[model samples]
Structures are given as C-alpha cells and as structure tokens.
Target: MDVLVLIGRVLFVVLFATSAVNHLTRSKAMAGYTASRGIPFATAAVLASGVVLGAGAVSVAVGLWADLGALLLAAFCFSAAVLMHGFWAEKDPQAKMAEQSHFFKDLALGGAALVIFAFFAYAGHDLGLMVTGPALSLG
Candidate 1:
C-alpha cells in the first residue's frame, strides 16, 4: 500500500517537474504560442505557470501542505485548459478533437489535484497538512 502511494507520488511529480523545466527552458517559444492564442502577458504567464507547476508538484511529492500545492496545480490546469485549449472555439472537427483532448487532460490533472487537496483536508491524513518527508515517501 505504501509502495503504491509512493510510486503514484513520484509519477505525479514527474509530469509537473518535467513540464516546468520545459516552460522555463522554452519560455520564448511558449510565450509566442501563448500570444498567438491571445493571452495577454504571454511570456509572464508561461513563466509563472512553470514556477507554480514545479512548486506545487514538489510540495505534493513531499506531502508538504499538499492542499496549497493542489490549489496551485488546479489553478494552473484549469486556466491553461481554458486559455490554451479552448476546444469549444474550434470549428474544424479534427482541430476541435485535438483541443478537447488537451483540455480534458488539463482538467483531469486539475481534478487529481483537487482530490489530493480533499484527501489532506478531509481524509484524516495527519501528514497532509505539513511536510512529512522527502519526495519518495507515502505521506
């Protein structure tokens, strides 16, 4: 049971951490794409999203105030889903499908984050409110 939880945590963190590295390393490209999508302050938004993603994923991986971490991720995911994907705005079926896929992916991540927050706040987990251990633990 503990091993499973630990593995899940690692897998979850990997997604966000890798994405953060991408955003930080490819800020210019991401920002340009974001601008193309009509999001204001595209560069800043991309940079900020990367920071939040990394920080939130790290916080959850270590079970350090995971509620806050989850909120960060939830915000980032939902916001990105709306601003970046916007599947409803697409007219072409193929394009809409692709955008919808991305949108749902983000929503799924956000949903997971919400569940994590709920687990800490209401699932009677002692270590969820604070930092319990390193990233490999099953807090």
Candidate 2:
C-alpha cells in the first residue's frame, strides 16, 4: 500500500510537472495565449505560476512538505480554471466545450489536491517515504 501510494503521488504530479516545464520553456508562447485571454502581466504571471507549480510538484513527489504542496497545487488549479479556462466567456460552441472541459478538469484536480491537503494536514498519515510530519497544522 505504501508503495502504491508513492506511485500514485508520483503519477499525479506528472502532469503538473510537465506543465511547469512547458510554462518555463515556452513562456513566450504561453504568455501570448495568456494575454489573448486578457490576463495582465501575462509573461510574469506565466513565469510565476511555473515556479509555483514546479515547486509544488517536487514537494508532493518527494513527500516533503506535501501539505503545503497540495495547497499550492490547489491554488494554481483553481486560479487557472477561473482565469484561463473561462468557458462562460467563450462564444463558439466548440471552443466553449473545450474550455468547459478544461475548466472542469482543473476544478477536479484542485478538489483532489484539497483532499490530499486534508489528509496530510489533519489526518497525519504517512506512506512510503512521506515525511512523518506535515508542514501545516490546520485542523
């Protein structure tokens, strides 16, 4: 079970880690798209989000300060859903559907991150090499 949990944690963070890499490596292109969505300081925002997400992914994967990592992941997911994948703002049916899918995906990821946060922050469980203590104590 511990091994499985470890695997799950690593797998879960893959998407986010990959996205973080893209945000850093392709910042200019991503910033253009972000700006097209009317995000202010799109370039800086992309770089900042990349750093946040990369740090969160590393924290979770290594089971170090995972509670804090979960919070960071949740924040990024929720903010991106609202700020980037605004389905309601789309006009074309296909585009709306695409945005809606992305919006829901981010929401689901955010929800899962919150659940992980609760487990580490409150339940105080450990799996595999997970740190024995949580970085947060919000019960």
Candidate 3:
C-alpha cells in the first residue's frame, strides 16, 4: 500500500510537472487556444494555468499539502476537460480524437485526485479550505 501510494504520487507529480512546463513554455499557443475558447484574457489565463500546474506539481512532489494540491489539480483537469476539450469534440476528426483522449485522461486524473483527497481527509488533512472556492484568485 505504501509503495502504491508512492508510485501514485510520483505519477501525479510527473503529469503535473510536464503540464506546467508545457503551459509555461508554450504560453503563446496556450493563450491563443484560450482566446479561441472565448476566454476573456488569454495571457492571464495561460499564466494562471501554469501557476496551478506548477503549484500542484510541487505540492505532490513534496508530499506537503498534497490533498489541497490534488483538489486544485482536479479543478484544473475538470475545467480543461469540460470547457476546452468539450468544445473541440465535434469539430474535426483528429481534433475530436485528441480532445476525447484528453477528456478521458483528465477524468482519470480527477478521479485519482479525489482518491488522494479522500485519503488525506481520512488521515485528518484539512480539505475544507482546499476546496472552498477558485484555485486561483486573480483579484
């Protein structure tokens, strides 16, 4: 069980780290994508996404406040799957496949995050504060 948890944590870290790097390095593309999706502020949106991904990666990697990290990541994946991926699902075949693949992947990640959140909750991790509102508040 311990080994499994470690492996799961590692996997989560790797996933979020890769995503963070991608969002950071490809800010222009990401911003354009967000704009295409009708997001009001593309640059701000990309930066915010990068921050969430980075914070989640760090939290999961360090195993310090991982439940909050997981919840934040869950929100990220959920929004990406529902808003971004869902919008592309029926437009183009290749795009649709990619979006669907991402949708399922995010769904799986969200499930894993929930599991981690549940574990932490049972272990007395304070999750009430983690999920109170938006993961990032620009204001």
Top candidate by lDDT: 2
* Per-residue lDDT of 21 in model 1: 94
Which digits, one per residue and each the tens of the lDDT, describe model 2 over residues 1-139?
7777679889999999999999999999999989988999999999999999999998888888888998999999999999999999999999999999999999999999999888778754544578655788766
Across residues 1-139, which tens digit of lDDT does each residue of candidate 3 receive? 5456657677767978888998888988889888887787888888899999899877765566766787888889898888777835477888788889988998998888877766664652323323232232223
Tens-digit lDDT track of model 1 for 1-139: 5555556766887889899999988999989989988999999988998999998988777777666777788889999999999999999999999999999999999999888767656642534334553222234
Candidate 3 segments exceeding 4 Å error? 1-4, 87-89, 124-139
All candidates in order of TM-score, best leading: 2, 1, 3
- Which 10-residue span in candidate 3 carries the lowest summed lDDT? 129-138
Every candidate's lDDT:
0.80, 0.90, 0.74
lDDT (Cα) of model 1: 0.80
Give the CA lDDT, 0 to 100, for residue 134 in model 3: 27
Q: Looking at candidate 3, what is the lDDT of residue 37?
A: 71
When sorted by lDDT, best at the front, the candidate numbers are: 2, 1, 3
